[model samples]
Target: MDITNFVVSARNQALLYGDYNTYHKQLAKKLHNCRKRLNIVTRNRGKFSKKEPISAEKLSENHEYLHLQLLTAERAWAHAMRFKAVHSADTKGITGRTRSHIISRLDKGARAAETLVNVLSDASTSGASDTDILEARAYASMLRGATQFEKQSWEPCLRSYATARIIYTALSTSMRGDIFKDLLSETIDPSIRYAAYQSKVPRTLAIPTIARKAFPSSDSALVEQINKLAPDLLKKSDSDAQKGQVGAPNAPQTITWRSREVKIEDAAIALALASTDTATALLEEKLASSDVTLPREMAAAYDEVLIASQDAADATKHAIDELKEEGVSQNDPRIQSLQITRTAVNYQMISWRIGRNRVLSGEHDGALLDSAPTTTRKSKKDATSRKPKIEPTGRKISRLKDKVVLYDSTLQSIDSIKELPGVAADEGLLEQLEATAKYFRALKSLSIARSHSLTDQSPNAYVLTKHAFDECQQSAALFSKHGASSSDSSPRNIEIRQADIQFLHNLLKGELQRTRAIVQIDSQRQKAAETVPPHGGSPLVQRLFEYPEGGANLNHLVDFPPKMDVIPVKPLFFDVAWNYIDYPGKEPVAATTPEPEQKTKQQAQSQKKGWFGFGR
Candidate 1:
C-alpha cells in the first residue's frame, strides 16, 4: 500500500465516524420529536398539524426520514378532515368509546415506532433494518386511522388499522395475537355493532348473560351483545350457579345491615302472603258449604285459619315498624300502603265471620231469590234441574252496587303503594329493593283486581288477571337479574314472592269461572222467585198493579250467592256485588263437602298439567 493512500484512508474513516455521531444525536432528538407529535395529535392538543418544524436538517437520512414520516401522518390527518364520513358524532357526540380506542391505538403505535427507531438509530448500529423501518411506518399509518376514527370516518379508520395489523404480523419475532390485539380491535366500530344489535337480538354476546335479563327494551340487545364480547370488559360470569357471595362482585361497597334487612322483609312478605292464602282457603271452604247448617268442625277449621291470618298480619306490622326505625318515614308510601291493606283485611274478615254466623243460625235465609211461599220452597237438587229463572231486582242490584264500593277501597289502598321508597344501602341492594317494591305493588294490584272482578256486574276477571301476569312476569325477570347473588340459582330471587303471584294468577282465572257460576245461580233463583207473589198484598191492589196477592216475608226475599257446588271458592268474601251496602254470604261454618267435581289422582294430575303446562 502507498503511504499517502494509507493516511487518506485513515482520515476518511475519521470523517465517517464524526458525521455518524452527529447523525446519531439528531436521530434521537427527532425520534423523540416523533413521539411528542404522537402525544399532541392523539390527545387532540391542536386543531392543525405542523405546530413546529423538525430540527437538524443536515442529519443523516435515518434521522431526517422518520421526521418526514411523522409529518406525513400529521398532514394525512389534517386532509382527512375534509370528508364528512367521520363527522356523524359532531351532533351526537365524539361517536363513542370506539373513537377513544382509536386514539389510544394510534398513540401506542406511535410509541412502538419510536421504540423501533431508537433501537435502529443507536450510534453502534450498522444501518436501519427493513423490518424496523416498516414497523415505524405502520405506526404512522395508525395515526391516520385514529384521526379518521375521531372524524367518524369508519371506513378509512378500518383500512388503516388493517394495514397496521398486517405490518405487525409480518414481524416474525414480534409478540403474539394478544399483544397486538388493540390494533385489530381498532378496525371495528362499536356504534355500528350497536346499530346492528337493534335489528337482531344476539344469542351469544361476550357480556354476562345474566345482565341481558335486566335489559329487554329495544336498546338493550346491542348492549348485551357488546358486554358478552367486550374484550376489555368484565369476564364472562360463572356458567353455572356458584356459592353465593356476601356482596355483588361488581359492586364497590360491601353489603350492610340495611340491605340484609330489606332482603329479609321482602322474603317475609312473600311468606305472609302464603299464610294468608291458606287461611283464606279454610275460611271460605267452611263458610261456603254451611249455607244453611252451622257445623262445629267447619267453624273450628275457620277459627284456625283466622288465627293464622292474624299472625301473618302481625308479622307484616313488625316488618313495617323495623323499617321505620331505619330512618324510613312513617308517612312513607311503602309502609303506609301496606298498612292500609292490613287494615282492610282485618275489618272485612271480621265482618265476614259475624255475617256467616248469622246465616248458619238461620237468622237469614240461604234462598237468594225473590221470596216464595214456605210451602213452595224447593230442594237445591230440584232447583238445579229448573231453567234459568232469577232476574236482577232493585234489591239485588243495590247489593251488587255496594260490593263495587268495597273493591274500590281495596284498589285505593294499592294505588297508595305506588312509587314507594326502597331500602337504604350503599351497595347495589337498593336496586334489589326497588324491584321488590314493584313486585309487591303488583301483588296489591292483583288482590284488589280480584275483588273488583267479583263485585263488577260486567265480566272483567280475565282482563284483570292478564294485568297481574304482566306485572309479575316483568318483576320476575328483574328479580332474577339485578343485585347479584352468590350463586346462579340462589334463593336471593325471593322465590316465594313469585310463588304467591303465580298462585294468585291461577286464582284469578278460577275466580272468573266462579263469578260465572254465581251469575248462573242468580239467574235460576230469579226465575224461581217470579213464580211466587208479593206478601200481604190487597187483592184489589194486586189485580190493579199486576202483583200477586200473597207470598213469603219480604225479609226472606233473597240470600247471598249460593256455595260453589264443587269446593267452595277459597276465602269467600262477604260483600254483595251491589252499591252503597254490602251483604256478606252470611253463612255459618259448614262440614267439608266432597267436591262435586272431584277427580281421581290421575285426573287431577292431568288437570294440573293442563292448567300449568306453560310453566313446563
Candidate 2:
C-alpha cells in the first residue's frame, strides 16, 4: 500500500509549497470529498451529520475505506501542526492552555493511527499486506512519540520513537526509496537522541544501540514480524555496538598530544580514530606488497586514512561547538580539553593530507626527476634485465609539472599546521615545520628548474637550481643538528630523515653544477653568434669570432676562398645633408632678396588698400 510513502509524500508536497495550515485545509477538502463520495454528506440545508468511524470489518469491502481512515488521522495531525506553525515564533512560547490543546489534538491523531494499525493487523478481516501493517504501526508509534514529547514524557517517548526507528531501519534496507532514510535522519534520530538525553541515557551510546535497548520486546508478535523482515536486526546491533565501543579491547580510548593525554569521551571520535589506524596499517600492507605501486594507487590508499582523520577532526569540532552552544566558558575544563583535542585531531588530519601529497610526488620527494612507473612487465631471462625507456622531453617536463603541484600542496599543508592551535607556542615544532616547508620548497624549485631546462631556459633553470641548492643546504643543516623528533619507521608528514635530506642535498648540488655549465655554454654560444656576422665577411674576422672548424685557411683572406662580397655603408647621408645645406645650384632661399618689381607692387597694393583692408 506504500502507507509511509503516501504520508511522507503528502507532507513534503504541502510543506514545501505552504505551511501546515495549507496542509490542514487540503486534508479537509479531501475528507469532504471522501464523505460526499460515500453519500454521507448533509444535502440541501438538512440537519448536520457526523461521519461514522471506519470499522475493521468494513475496511475489506473497499480500499477507499482504508484511505478514509488514513486521511482522518492525517487531518487531525495537520490541525495540531497548524497551531504549532502559527505560534512557533512567539517569544512568550506556547501557553499552558495552548499546549494542552495541541497535545489533545495530537493524541486524537495518535489514537486514530493506532486504531488503523489494529484494523490493518487483523489476519481474518484486514485485507492489508504485512508491509502495510508494519508501516501503519511505525506511523502510529511516531505520532505517539510526538505526543509524548510535547507532554515531557521522556521514557514513553523514547520507547515509542525506538519502535519507529527499528521498523524504519528494517524497511530502509528492504525498500527501494529514501523515505525511510530521510525519516530517520530528519525526524526519528533527533527525537530519539533528545528523549534519550532526558531519560538519562549516556551520550556515548549511539542511536542504534539506544533504539535496540529501548525497543518494546514485550510485544512478541511485533518482534516476530520485525525479525522476519530483518532476521538479524536486533542481534547484529549488539555485536556492532560492542565493536564500536571506545572501551573495546581494540578501540583506542585516549589521544595524546605533546605531553598531555586526553580521554576520548565521544564515541564517534574514537571510532574514527580507530578506523584511521586500521587504514594506516592497510596502506602499509598494500605498499609493502607492491614493489612499484603507482602514485595514484598509493594516493587512493591514503584517501581512506585521510577521510577517517577528517571525520575525527570534524567530530572534535562538533564536540567543542556543542559545549560552547551550552554557554560553557572557554576556561571550563571541558572546553579547554576539547580545544586541545581539536588541535590534535586537526594536526593529524593535515599530516595525513600532506602525507598523501608526498606520496603523489615521486621518490625522494621529487628531488630526482624519475618517470612514474606505469607498467609492471617482468622478465624471465634475467629477472632484473629490464631496460629503461627514455621518455620524451615534453613528457618528462609534464611529469615534473605534476610533481611541482604535489610539492606545492605539501607546502600549503605544512603552513596550515602552523596555524593550528598550540602549534605556534612550541619553538621546536615550529622549527621542524619551517624545515619541512623548506624541504618541499626545495623540491618544488628543483622540479621547476628541470622543466625550465627541458624547455632550454638555461639561465632561469640555473637560477632556480641554485636557489634549490641553498634551500637544500639549510634543510640538511637543520636535520643534521636536531633531526626528526618522531622515530616511527612508518611514513608520515614532517618526518624528514637525515639520509633523504643528504640525498636531496647531493642531488641539488649536482643539478646546480650541471645547470651552471649549460648556462655558461649557452652564454658563449650567444656571444659567438653576436660577434660573427650572418653573411660571410672576411675569413679573418669570422676566425676571430670562433676557431675555424676545418682549420685556418691561409689561402683565403676575404671569404672562404677570397670571393667578392658587398659591404653596407651610408650612401644617402651626404645626399640627405646636401638637401638641408646650401649648395651652388640650390642656395638658401632666406639669404636672397625679393625682386624690385615685386617689392614695388607690394607697396602699391598697400597704398591702394584702405584701413582694415577695405579697397579704396
Candidate 3:
C-alpha cells in the first residue's frame, strides 16, 4: 500500500484508541527507518537510469509516492494536537478519565504519521536529489519527536508545516498527484492563525511570549484577544487576595474573572486620618519646644514655627471638612483633631494679632508726642493742672511717684533770680540789645538755658567793658527809683537781668510751639503750600520794617557810611601863644628893645587879622 493509504488507515486506528503513547513509540521507530532510506536515495539520485528504465510514467509514480508521504506527514499533525490537549489536561490535574481519553487519541495520530514518513523516505532515497531527501527526513524527524507536542512546543510544528506548505504550493500540477494536489489546494488548515491568536493568553500569569513575537504582524483577532485578556489579568492581580502580597506574577491565571470596584469614600477617610496624624505631631513638637526657655533669636524662630504649624493645622481642618462632605464620619479622630487644631490656630492668631496692634499703637503714640500740639504745656496753669496724677494702684504707680519726687528735687536746685549777681553798668543799650538777641538765638538753639553765661557763646564775654560799665549805671539808676516800690528786698539789678532772660525764654518757647503746630497741621493735611495773593503786603516787604541799624530805607541800612567824619580834630597851639605870638615872624626888625607900643600895635594887628582874616 502507498504511504498516503497507510497514513489514512493508521490515523483512523489512532482515533479509535484515543491515546497517543503506543502510537508515538511506533511512529518514532517508523520515522527513524524512513530517514535512513531517504539518505540512501539522495546519495544514489545522480546514478538513476534515464535512457532505458527511468521513463515519464515512473517519474509520475515517484511524484505520487512523495505526495502521499506529505499527506501522511500532514495527518501526523493530528497526533501533535491530541498530545497538546492531553499534556495540558494532565498538567492542570484534570481527572484521570478525561486525561486517558486525550492520550488515546494522541497515540493513534502519532503512529499514523510515523508509518507514512517511513514509506515516503524509502521511496525518495532510491533516486531523489539531496533536497528531496532532506525534506523527507525533516518531515519524519518532526513526527517522531512526540515530546515537542507533549511539552506544548509549537515552534517546531509551525516551522515544519510552513516548509511543507511552501513546497507543496511550488510543485506543478503534473508533478504532484491529483489527490495530494486537491488536499493542498482545497483544504485550509487554520492552525497557524489559531495558534497565533491563542498565544495572546489573556488570563495567563506569564506575559504572552507568542503575542509579543507576532505584534504588528499579528492578526487583528489576536490583538483583540490580548486587549480582552489584559484587563482581566490586571483586575485579578489587584484583588483583595493579593493584598500585602509580593513577587506575584503580573498576569492573571484566568481571563474570565472580573475586578471589584474601589471605594472612594474609604480612600478619602484614610487620607484624612493620615493628615490629622501629621498635624498632631507638628503641634506636639511645637508645645515641647515651647516648654523650654528661649533666647531672643530662638524665640523669633519659635514664633515662625508657631505660624507655620497653625497654617498646616488650618489646611488640615479644611481637608477634614471636605472629607466630611464626602460622607466620612465626623467623629473620627482625624475629624475631631481638625476642630481642635483649628481652635488652637485661631487662639494663636488672635493673640498675635492683638499684640501686634498694641505695639504699633504705642509707636504711633510716641510719634504723636513729637508732632502734635496736644502734648505741649500751653500755659503755666495748664502745665500745673495737666500734671499726671499720682494714684498709687500698684508697684508701677509707686515707682512713677518716686520718679516725680526726684524730678521735684531737681527743680528746687534752680536758684531764685534775686540770689544771682547783677551785671556791670558800662553795658550800652546796643550791647544789651545784641546780648538779648544772642540770648534768643542761643535759647532757640539750645532749647534749655538758665542764664547767659551758661550758653557756649555767652554774650557777656563779647560785650565791651565800657558797655558793661554803662549798663551798670543804667541798672543802678533804675534800682534806686524802683527799689522803694519793689516788694522783694533782693537786688533790683538782678531782677532786670532776670526779666531779659525770661523774655528770651518766652520767645523761644513761642517759636517752638509754632514749629510743633506746623508739623501737626502738616501731618494731618499733607498739602503743599498754596501760592496765595498777598492780602495787604507780602511777607518779604513786611520783614523789611524790622530792619536793624535804624536806616530810613532797606537799601540805606544795608549800606551805611564809615565813622571817620565824626572824629574831633586836635588844637595846634595854646591860648597864650595865640595872643602873644601875633605876627611873631613879622615883628619890627629889632631896634633894641623895640617899643612896647609897637609890639602891642603888631599884636592888635595880628589879633585883628586872626579875627577878620586880613594881615596888618
Q: Give the top-scoring candidate (TM-score).
A: 2
**Which lDDT tens digits does candidate 1 get at residues 1-616?**
1111222243245446664334334444544576664453434564565645332232233354444444344333323332323554475644456456545545554554454344444424425445444455455555655655555565555455544544444442343444344443443223222222332434122112222232222534323433433332223353321111111122111112322322222323334444545555555665556452333333355565456556546755765665575567877865765555454334334433433332222211111223222334478998899887564354444443333343344334333433223322223544554454455444445444544554664245445545655665665667667632334222111222444434544554565566567657767777766765444432333254444445534543333343344555755443333333434873332357546464364356556663455311
* Model 2 stretches astray by more than 4 angstroms: 15-26, 41-48, 76-102, 236-239, 242-250, 372-390, 480-482, 485-494, 524-556, 562-616
Candidate 2 residue-wise lDDT, 163-186, digit = tens? 999999888767874899899989
RMSD of each: 35.2, 10.5, 40.7
Which residue segments of model 3 deviate by more than 4 Å? 1-5, 12-125, 129-138, 141-157, 175-188, 198-616
Clashes of each: 31, 0, 27
What is the Cα-based TM-score of model 3? 0.19
For model 1, what is the error of residue 179's alpha carbon versus the real structure, in angstroms, after optimal superposition? 8.7
Error of 2 at 451 (Å): 2.2
Answer with 2 or 3, whichever has the higher TM-score.
2
How high a TM-score does candidate 2 get?
0.79
Off by over 4 Å in 1: 1-61, 75-134, 140-157, 166-616
Error of 1 at 178 (Å): 9.9
Best by lDDT: 2
Q: What lDDT, from 0 to 1, does candidate 2 have?
A: 0.81
lDDT values for all models: 0.42, 0.81, 0.38
| Residue pairs with backbone atoms closer than 3 Å in model 2 (clashes) | none
